[model samples]
Target: MAETAAQFPEVQGGGSLIVAWQVKGKTVLVVGGGEVAAGRILHCLNADALVTVVSPAARLNPEVAYRVAQGQVAHVDRNFEPSDLDGADMVLVAVDDPAASTAIWQLCKARRIPANIADVPPECDFYFGSVHRDGPLQIMVSTNGKGPRLASMIRKFIAKQLPSDAGRAIETVGQLRVRLRQIAPRPEEGPKRMAWMSKVSEAYPWDEMCGLSEEDIGNLLRFYPSGKVPALDELKAMRANPGADKEAFDGSFGFSVGA
Candidate 1:
């Protein structure tokens, strides 16, 4: 299955590169420096993973190493050790330690821990992909560990489709959604009990939060009748009307429908 997929129809490049990374609170070991290590660190931070970066020498990115010194990250100086995998869930052996990293790779494979060994193809369990972030959303693009440059170029393509302001609006609504569910009368069925919830998305006005207070969400909820919440499709439409070409509607969540 794995061998054929490597050479199969879409897995080569043109397919939807899909993967679910189990990263929340998982321990990640990153070794090495320069741009590669910085990129990996940022990716890990996005996942909220517990990352421990090991490096012998320091670089210009003091904030990178600062996180380690401040105990936000665990750093190991000098060489890579076999026991480094003591409690690691994911390992990234990045650097010029081909021999040492290959040894670490063998150890990870022995323990069934997923690991990526930089520079050595055979020693890797997986590889890093290009990534994009739209506020709370994260998208990763990979070429099955083959083409990094192409992956980056694909990221640019993704950037064009996503609205620059979409993330902020979504995040603002998400926070309100959480709070709204808690105070809602039929809390368990909050989604089904709010008629205007979807329309609210069409005009969330994240930038004009200058005019909103915590009271606005409460007042809005009070106006909603019982057992009449909005559906996701409606909310999506209110965000970017699904009825048409699915572009942002004039009365979309970003603009006040009454405005």
Candidate 2:
């Protein structure tokens, strides 16, 4: 029988390019100090971006004021100014005055800078999505500015379905990868290293992988040169008896013979 080809429906619109942007050490300018602006500032700070808010000191909400007071963000203590865009890699406008916000957006467009204007979808170069963050994992849901509340609801729903240790499992895998790199330090060994890592990942289930410790990784590294994947029982035994002789185990790494 001939295989059937898969068909997919055409998308209605070209959605925004979803990406994990690395904004560490980049300049992000925020043109407001109200509640909305406060949220933007927090998000920028979380990304390790250098954030500066251009709003009058009196206009700053309590949250914004607290951040400014703690020296977490720089405050311009005045309304938006054209010069404020200098050295800014990204801009976020959240001022209450629609006219001023529009002017700021225009300046950003003229300078070819990326900007997000609050409550003005047409003028925005980007839109903020509702984000759910774990240690090193982040899930974002966006509605393309059509229905933000619905997007947020969806985000919450997704978060509840994820395992609590999902982030820790990712972190454990990262540690194993780093150890593997140290073992295979030559560029020519990349393919073999990747193959071994893939085998190890497949051999262990999520819960087992999450429970792996630094000692377990060391034991796994022993089989790297031979490209052998250790069974779960072999791993447990190795943990139980750190000084056990490897030669005592069968070549199948604790797996029984074909029976």
Report the lDDT of model 1 for residue 40.
76
Pick out the ten consecutive residues of candidate 1 with the lowest summed lDDT.
232-241
Per-residue CA lDDT of model 1 for 15-113, tens digit only, reads: 443676878899998876546776777778778889887777554156667676677667777566778788999988777756777788888999999
The TM-scores of all predictions, comma-separated, are 0.65, 0.85
Candidate 1 residue runs with Cα over 4 Å from true position? 1-17, 58-72, 183-223, 226-259
Which pairs of residues collide in model 1?
A: 192-229, 193-228, 193-229, 194-228, 194-229, 201-253, 202-252, 202-253, 203-253, 204-253
Candidate 2 stretches greater than 4 Å from native: 1-14, 206-208, 241-259
RMSD of 1: 8.5
